[model samples]
Target: MMAGAQRSQTSFHFCHNPHAGSLLQGLQELRSDNLLTDVILCVSGKEIPCHRSVLAACSEYFRAMFCNGLRESKDYKVTIHEVSPDALQLIVDYAYTSEITITEDNAWQLLEGANFFQILPVRDACVTFVSNNFSAKDCLQMMQVGNMLSCPDLEKNASLCALKEFTTVSKTPEFLSLTKDQLITLISSDDLNASEKTVYRAVMTWINHDTRKRKKEMRELMELVRFPFMDKLYFLENVDNNNAVRKSCQDILTETRRYQLFPEEVESPCTRPRRTSGLREAVLVFGGLEKMEIGENPAVFSNSITCSPEPSTSSWTRVSRMKRKNDSRFAVAVLGTRNVIVSCGAKSRDVWLYHPELNSWHKLAQMKENRYHHKLAVVQGKVYAIGGRNLSSESSPWTSVEVYDRIQNKWTESVSLPKSRCGHAVAVVDGNIYVMGGLDTEYKDTSTVYRFSPGDSQWQSQTDMPLTTYAITASVLNGNIYVATLTNFLCYKPCENGGSWSVVVGVGTLCMYGMTVLWWESSHLWWL
Candidate 1:
């Protein structure tokens, strides 16, 4: 019985044949000698003898045509249309031997044939060949071909190449051949990597290429130029005075003028700064008390605004100073246009907008409530001021929340917080507001976390923090909220385990009280 049981576990092992690599070679030799050739593929009046089994084994197109009980299955000859003879010959050779040489003169035809034949390996090889040979002069052509062949990788790479070398790509003849919609899509991309002036010039060049036909597209195309972000002198000299722009695009020109004259009043696509123009990722530190001198008062507040270009830079440049010297505990948030909004925390309703390009501060509409130690968050193009204590009111910790309306130039009340708290850390992820650890109305630290969505009447309570700590700072990175407390750095993943908190690193020794954490340059967290 034991022997029979052991026999039941016995199995035969099969090893790979060492000579299997020569099978394809032998098939190629058979095709060379025209031995047992069962099919002939005809392309452009040229015929090539091939094996039905080999073609069927290598190509889905051939398998579907020959093995699906179609009329072509019993036929000895098949005619392929819209494919060049040379491309067909190469594809047939590759099907048998798994190899083909692609040259510049033959790449497009080979890609088209491979795509038509549903041969993925050959199609991928052709895509790689074209991508490796991409240049500024022909990248637009490559992009068009990739689009035609439905090759996403090739199309994306070619598009990126054109954007990175936009100045040179715009000079190519292929650029002039782009359709009106294609031109608009290209210029509207924030990743164009060219100044607004260069984009404007490229539009003009395209217009002039076929002025009789494309001249009518001036208004539609000019809307994508972002004239407010362009150089002021260049806009006035080259764009404003140009006859075509002056004549047909007076309304757009008027909007551009309004943007230039009153930037805060205008919030349009033309006013948003592109990365190539002047928008950059930098660490900005707002109002806080400076380091105390030997004999200076510790209560002295600092109004200087400074920024570090990157995390690696050790030096910080003083870009601008706040208009009010006594501003402290101010809640700051960056607008969608990359402008910094500073709401005074010195028991005043005054708010200021810091324009990075002008290196100046402009006063914005005041808040509805006089509160200090409040938190600010920008969600969905609107700024929300969260909980803080009002000095004059007997109800010290106010639960009211207000949102700043750019169009109305005023602050209106939104949904209030669940609990009245100040010195809380706020961060926005996926258009939702997250309020972290802070001191409650009873002046005791609370570990409760609350999430609020716009247009919702109530804030949803989230998982409690690991520890109850106040004066914490929080920032969102990679869709996770990272909170820095006096003792440790914690991270909260909203999508993990129904939203949970975990300690990321121990920073108790850093004593990070009253510091703000910011995620800059899409990497590296700076505490200030």
Candidate 2:
């Protein structure tokens, strides 16, 4: 009876078999021989306790085995508190002795727990799970999240998925808001069908059309829409004379015809005259009295200077001290090739033409008479100096006018003013010079405005200005003449067929000087 009882206890202790018991006893005998072993296992939250027996049964494996499938791993500082009781027991048993037999079915659950715990090896296992299960539907939200987090790999994967379905995705308003250039790349590449490309362009045009958010941007969009048609016209005229080509060109012109004013109304309170050649950036204005002082220690003198844009003020930087000193008046205009011609008042007999690019001055042929406070303008590529005075005697102002032909580099006599006037203002609008309010025959202020056409050599009557303003400034903006009245400013919109002037919005009150009202194409201003 004692022998039988011992056998039963040994069988239960070894668990699997009597030979397994004998082998375990033999392994135990070798324990004192400094033996080493390792084991790894993965199990579900409920299977942890069962893993404890396996770990104890294979004690030799515990010597060097590393277990990563636990919800809490000893590698990082993070401790897992929400582990199941059974899983916790399994983890503890594995920690005490690294022996376990985790089955494949339970491997995924443990891998998920390991991922949550951020155990790198186990987290890697979960990524493998994803790679094995990747699908088109799974990529949408994943890519969005990846992009939001700046995850480069995930963004690429998501973009690939979106591109796969590009042909099928309808061009909704939401889709239109996507980056147009990116969509265009997809369209132009052979990756999409011809129909898809056509649809995309149509949708893009619809989305970008008729937008007036900025006047400049609107103009650009209109140009973009017209380019294809323009190309067709050019191709027809040069490459082919076929009836189809001619018909196509005619149709395009009809579709894209733009009715522009002969004198384009450049939007402004601009301080410079309209360019004869249509271009955007302003030609720099130089040569004027910028400063004046009244003491002898520094030698008091009046000098005019330039002020440019605020940052580095690149447009026009002012220079100090006039080359010659005198009581001065001036008329400034931009002529051919971006050169500015400045005819000074009676201050000097020398005609100073300023070259902005060179930052220097040059003397031109002298005017026929010494005229100051006269109105000067560029008309049809010619400079006309009108109605100024000679201080040679106190006798007073002159109404004589002279036209300087820039192309010929010679002065031609033109029809003189209706009367002798000084301190008057002149601005060229739509090829006609409008000479307005000045000190008239009696040296008192006058409100009369006269229009001169060099083409006809004739003077016509016009409505008087609202006020008598001398030493005022005038500019043209958006095709309308903006007159800087002495204390205020007014707008003049030329009639389409030529009759009268109409008022535009009144600008704010004046800040006066011997100001030249220039249409600073960039800012559109009337300046002091």
Candidate 3:
């Protein structure tokens, strides 16, 4: 009866022995005992003896072939195609001992071998090794290898490297060797760093590489060049001087001329200049502390730095210092990728815009209100400076909202918040403005949430956050709002019956100053 009762419980505590799990135990004996390897793999005139069951278990390709009744299942000798024997041997060794060494020479071929056999772990490992060591110099070859093997992630990474370093990349032999289609795809990208004239120069170089052979394809390739984006001087000097423009390239050059002469005549369209943004995948963090210098607030702006997606390889290098001083009452926003505006609240009553790439500053019109603790957010290119407190007293909260028209260089008053609040968080999610958590007029902490749409004159109340606080950081991911408080992380699903905040468990964390939140492509929150 006791045994039956114990069996009915259906749960057991199982123990594992350390010796049995250790690779140090009896490996020499197992090496000697060699259970008579059932298969031989042939590659590059070399034969590697391996167990068919082990290889089949380690690879999906072999698994389906051996277990699903395929032709290769009964064969004792299998010939590996395309991959060199050294790489194949490494892959086979990994199958038996779960270990393999990847070197610079063998990394690419080893990855090809792993992918051919459908061994994801080794392939992923190779992908990491290749990409972490990637640079503009080797990116072309890496891109070719990745594309040939159909490894999309590696292909994208290599392309990003190439695009970011295009000026140097275009000078390489590989770029010159690219097929017409490949070159067109490259120059057609909006992210290319080179100017349209530079791209035109590159195209000319390619055409002149084997002019007689490539001339037939020149007109088709010329269409990919955005000639209107070229400087008027460069267009006259380069494009007008080219013999191809007078000959077969006449149609494309004519279209560009028409577009530039009459931009309103949209019969032919031309590409406009794009904002300069570094690193296709990255996070921009803005934060500054109020450092008192002998009872004075000096302008203290830190150097601008960018980090790569991989945190370990990144460092913050100072670019430029701030042009002015402020202890508080500061609000910041990004105006496209071209401008970063850092404005201070009342008493200072001024605005400054900085270009990160050029390290240049531009002074702009002042804001109407001068409240410190205000929050600034850019929604669809318009800067919205939200509620804040009076400079004289922290207790006096401002209910007013100011919208900055970047084109006009002026700020106009908009409908105020539902209540006078300060130190609140504002985020733009799916074209709607979501404002959450702040101290009310009485200087008491509250978790009140409000939202405003584009045409709405007044803010609408939403689900209150779980924590009561004057400060919170918000970001949007996968079409949901993620709000992190001083102590907890919460997510709000707008698609749900009535917006509600649900706790997301077990994402490790430490506190970040300024409470800046950004959505990472990896579906995790990046704090700055």
Candidate 4:
């Protein structure tokens, strides 16, 4: 009885003090002295901490049991028994002092156990070690595991580190495994400010590849990842440093034309070859010209006509006109629904749909408001009436935005603009509504540009035009926003450092509105 009582007391003392002797020696002593605690071995082959009293209290023989096999086989080797002696000591101290001393060897394993058990000290200690000694490999592995474990802070750190490395050097085969979106996330990060120069140079060079607009798309993807404040300031500055960067990268790419930097361009899945019809016939629609001399109340003439991108050498023929005429600001947009052209603007509230085949006018309902000097854009079969003047006798700028749905045969009012603008040009580039070059309240021309996002229903200011001018024309061709003013044309793109615009070379224009665009493209061509 004396011996049994002494053994029970010794076992109790050992349970209260795990570090009273070597971990293995203490375990052997506890077995000899008496059973102090019961360690539950999960089916995953992981040992869990449990007091003997707690085990005794349970009806089941094991303190804990796995209902099913763990999903990951890697968890098998990461057991409490397999943990190094040093880590075991830390684990024991973590339960007692709540202070964990982590070492590199067992940091990950300890963290796994700590995370599984929801022990704060051990988990934190593991995090501290990993953060301080983070390597490329460690970051890569941790990024995958941490993200899965919902360890946000650790995942963020690992992602940032990997992205920083990707930016610093040309993305390797290993790094290229990251999605384009992920690469973009790193490029736009503020933490990598120190690595910006190297990262930007590498990223710019790598993405500027000539795999049929691949570089152009990468540039766009980078723009999308940009922080909102940075993009706003960048566009407001009116500089297109991308051209210079592109030029430099082009120079580098020119040397390495032999290398296949980008994956072969995949032909668009939705693209269908345009079927050629015999005779290449086209129909011409003419309307009233602007009544220049207001001294004479111009014959309430119906001049606004829907013009197609007709091939050169076509005749002047009248097809359709607006029901009400107010010096129709003529711009034609091809509707996707019926293969018809919609003569959109004139501030008359009425839209005339012209079928080139039928050569007839179909009058649609009036717009929400009268708009003039506005541009029309067709996006996903929806007609968007962008910036223009809300025509009234008082002559004020228009801020109201409207969209027409062909399927529903209705016009719905969208969010308005920040400013009432007129004579502005709008282009839908990658679902972003870019409003550029217009007159404000005072009718003073502007070079300011604003980008409207449908996702947020808000406007974000972007790069301004190089020269302020109203009645400018804007279009997106080959992923570049080309703006043509009365006298000049310029291409503006986002800068590499990312929050400003840089203008490319100025192009010469032969004439305004309907003038031949020949001078800008090549040498000279006559215009009527």
lDDT of 3 by residue, 31-62 (tens): 33664666677877898776667777789888
Ranking by lDDT: 1, 3, 4, 2
TM-score of each: 0.63, 0.45, 0.52, 0.42
The models' CA-based lDDT, in order, is: 0.83, 0.52, 0.72, 0.54
Best candidate (score: lDDT):
1
lDDT-wise, the better of 1 and 3 is 1
In model 3, pairs of residues that clash are 299-325, 329-345, 346-370
Task: Point out the higher-scoring one by lDDT: 1 or 4.
Answer: 1
Put down candidate 4 lDDT per residue, 24-45, tens digits, no spaces: 4555455445466444323344
Candidate 1 worst ten-residue window by lDDT: 512-521
Per-residue lDDT of model 1, residues 349-438, tens digit only: 999888887897888899999878789988656889999887554656768899998777789999999998888899987668999888
**Runs in model 1 lying further than 4 Å from the true structure:** 1-9, 17-20, 208-216, 242-251, 258-267, 282-330, 335-387, 391-528
Tell me how far the alpha carbon of residue 231 in candidate 3 is from the true structure, in angstroms, after superposition.
5.5
lDDT score of model 3? 0.72
Candidate 3: TM-score?
Answer: 0.52
